[model samples]
Target: MVSFLFLDFDGVLHPQYDGEPTPKEVCFCHLPRFEAVMRRYPGVQIVISSTWRQQFGMLQLRAFFSTDIARRIVGITPTYPADGPPRMHIREWEILQWLKQHHASNKQWVALDDSQGDFRDYRHRVVFCQPWEGLSEHRAVQLSKALQGTRL
Candidate 1:
């Protein structure tokens, strides 16, 4: 069974913005549906796997979920290394590393992100979303179906 749902904040939960974009600056449209889905599936872990860590740090997590349910989140994977240059690749690496550390294979979880490049190996496991679009009813339905074992 899929035990975890890894989320990318900018394109999946919040609108993708370059400058002046903070979690507080963006609105969460599909949060109600997301909460509904979560309520329907207990014990399923949700992890923030976004690059916001590199841009805004850990505070972004609380800021993003400030008005929504926060208890569902289990962990977060930061986008950049503490001492290295900022790179989106770090996010993907961190995700894979996290999965490896937890002994969870690709089939056991899902990654919802905007970038569809380097993650080709796990493409079947990822739910790719457009950069400017946040979560929508279709994506929520897709997530619900995937959680129910229908891959898409």
Candidate 2:
């Protein structure tokens, strides 16, 4: 049983950034991909592991996701801490802390993020994504396979 699926909203779910000249929102492309993955794996628990906490509160975040793929999520973790060196760097720490608090070991969790850098010592468990390569069909299939292999 896969205990938790940590998802980064921006690049993985939505596009990497906003305010582009094309005016095409990243989120528009995300919904379909996210829905497809959700349909194939309904038993997995989804958690919001995005770094958008600086701009949106938990309520706003919940509402945003609820409008799109709400049924896929079990719950959102506490908003990422604000007072940190930088917003991007804090998510890894916050994720680790949350896992420890809930007694969810790394083996039972998989973090999908666009940040390609090593996750310090937890590099083995994280699934890194590229900014341009938002969740693809092949990646989703791989994730499903990984989840199945996870030790409950």
Candidate 3:
């Protein structure tokens, strides 16, 4: 009865403010806050659902977090074709694809992302993060509560 957490890096891990990019040194600044919440819920496993996965390998991606937290990140979602069918919720589609591949379609899961439109069809399954604030305490608390429920 393991729960899944689809993690996004750019907007959710660090501030990805509009008009300007975040400095590399300032990236992942909110990771500690996110890790703290994950620590409270050890049963929740994470999967990288960020675009960063397209550029970096799994090991490199995991290096962003503390060792303990890194291990909890089991895998990354499958990438979709850029020219595939027209769709508004590509992120949601990718999450479902990952769940299906793992044979965990029935498992409890949620996505942490800044783009609400990406999860329009499954709004209830997403813990929206503000790109300008990243994983603030408020967003972390929401994530904690989402994971607090008993696994189905």
Candidate 2 lDDT, 8-120, residue by residue in tens? 86667655655342225546366566666655666767777775655666667667554445655655555554564554445567677777777665536777777755256
Off by over 4 Å in 1: 19-25, 54-69, 78-90
Candidate structures ordered by lDDT, highest first = 3, 1, 2
RMSD per prediction, one decimal? 3.6, 3.9, 2.0
TM per prediction: 0.75, 0.71, 0.93
Colliding residue pairs in candidate 1: none
Query: What is candidate 3's lDDT per residue for 32-90, written digit by digit as tens?
Result: 89998899888889999998999999899989899999999999999888778888888
Clashing pairs in 3: none
User: How does each model score on lDDT?
Assistant: 0.69, 0.63, 0.87
Looking at model 3, residue 77 earns an lDDT score of 96
Model 1 local distance difference test score: 0.69
Candidate 2 CA-lDDT value: 0.63
Q: Which ten residues in a row are the worst by lDDT in model 3?
A: 143-152
Among the numbered candidates, top TM-score falls to 3
* TM-score of candidate 2 against the unseen true structure: 0.71
Candidate 1 lDDT over residue span 39-94, tens digit each? 77776787778755556644557665634456667677644457876555555677
Q: Tell me the lDDT of model 2 at 142.
A: 64
Order the candidate numbers by TM-score, best to worst.
Answer: 3, 1, 2
